[model samples]
Target: MRKPRRGAVILLIVCLFFLPSCEAIDNDFSIWDKLFNPVWDGDFSSLNYKATYPENNVTSGGNMEAWLDIVGWFNMSRINGTDYIYGDPANQSITEYNAIDTLGWNDNMDWIKHELLYDVVNDTLIVQDNITMLWHHSEEKTTSEGHTYIQKTYYYSYLTVYDSEIIPKQYVYDGQNIEALITFYNNSINPKSVIFIPDKLGLYSIDYTYKNESVHEDLMTGYVENNSKGIEFVNFTYNSGWSDPGGNLSHIGVCAVVKGGNFTPDNLSIDIYTPYEQLNITNYNLSTCNLFKGERSMHILLFPILLIIFSPFLLIYFIYKRAGR
Candidate 1:
């Protein structure tokens, strides 16, 4: 009995020695999180920042961070807005918005569902967004529309520049706007107020009204994938219901603020050329990941296999030694 107990202890030690070094693999971390863990990326010190969307007091609530993997989402503001308000008679941009994080609220926008999915091949994130608007979230509705509001699928892809910053690679968001416009026009319903964001070089807002697609068609004809002047920031607003207290949780607009502040819209007070010149694009995926660094990674990954093979021999040796004693 004593011999068997001693052998058992040896086996446990062996098991401990052979476990995978990456804690994320075995733990609750999603495969997406495990694969794209920032630890493996080299020197993302640039993307690491304390504040995002400093304007409009975005930091007032918080930000949807995208260091390399779009760290966390904000309330889900879909686009940015400036003093430049668009639409006819009344503005249709997101006037009411939420700045809090998803995890902070127990709402319909589950953190798990909306979390950024990792695209291993390209090192990108597939952002999934589906939420109702704030005014429409209320149980009671004044609009002729029966359901009050509809949830539209808003998904986009973002690329990580490793140590640098993340950018929109696919430029699929323009199609999204078209879909939303079709819905509002088809249903003949007035949407929420919009804050026209004039951060681009030559931004022109369509004097749009409820159910008017022709006016906005020219504006949406082609989306700007690359803002040569560099994009100031982009915001997205989405609404989630407050399940607990039983009311609207308001709206959340996720802001992806550029860190270096190198790019400002065609501003009169700010020097666009100076800021644009200051912009720096770092080489992406230049170094090996943190844990899986060169041959060292191989050894770490293989450590367990070696230990398993040696454990039996180690146990036998220990038993022989104990008997001799």
Candidate 2:
């Protein structure tokens, strides 16, 4: 009887802890089964951290390690036309005007310029990107397969994501007719705001803020200075000054084609990075970009592909060498 009573209490606590996490996903549960499956789905695009922390006051069990449900989905196109919603239209944070091609998102800084101040007392740093996305104010299921294990599963929208919007002034979800903040135009920009900061301590922070307003604003404290120093204790951001060499290697400076030699760093840094909000893959369809990411054995096949492309030349050279012999 004591064991049974203890079990009930644990179960209730577990439910309350995970309930907020559920809000980020949709109804389907099959995708979750793949979470632990040994088989590779060949879709790294489908491979994402969970749907991310729910924005509308929901919490990730007080540890928002999955990042936050930090992006919004807007209908950038019309039913009669193609997806003007560029790239994967999945984790985008900026907005663009359909009319004017040049002067874009009238107030774009709201999304990128934020200071996630480090807490000296708590030894933590917390900040948010695109708080207006919460206005998008945002369900679940399960299946039987011999319940040998209990894993928390999350699913994403096959719809609904693109089906909603809550951009301020420029757009309101479901035609809500409102204005707020953040408007950026230019190539579906989803800049990693945290990356822009020079003194960022993201690699070291260990906890997330539990109770408070979700709009994160506080800069990383002074720690590392590259070629220059930022204001004292100010968390400065730095978008790479180098121009894109024409493709999607966001951190072009780290790539072999660009600045590829000793991959070791002179300072404390992360090699690859996406926007903190990019982990919020709520409306993103994972199927669209697997081949591009070189997942699904695309990297495995690259050798065969190159071998075939140059096989004829190799054969000719081989025959010429044999004839010479």
lDDT of 1 at 188: 13
The top-ranked prediction according to lDDT is 1
- Tell me the lDDT of model 1 at 177: 18
lDDT of 1 by residue, 253-291 (tens): 211111121222221011111101211112111111134
State TM-scores per candidate. 0.15, 0.14
When summed lDDT is taken over every stretch of 10 residues in candidate 1, the lowest stretch is: 179-188
- Tens-place lDDT per residue, model 2, 100-207, is 111123211111121222111232122332211100101122447644543433321110111123322221123112111111111112221111222222221111
Regions of model 1 farther than 4 Å from truth: 1-175, 178-325
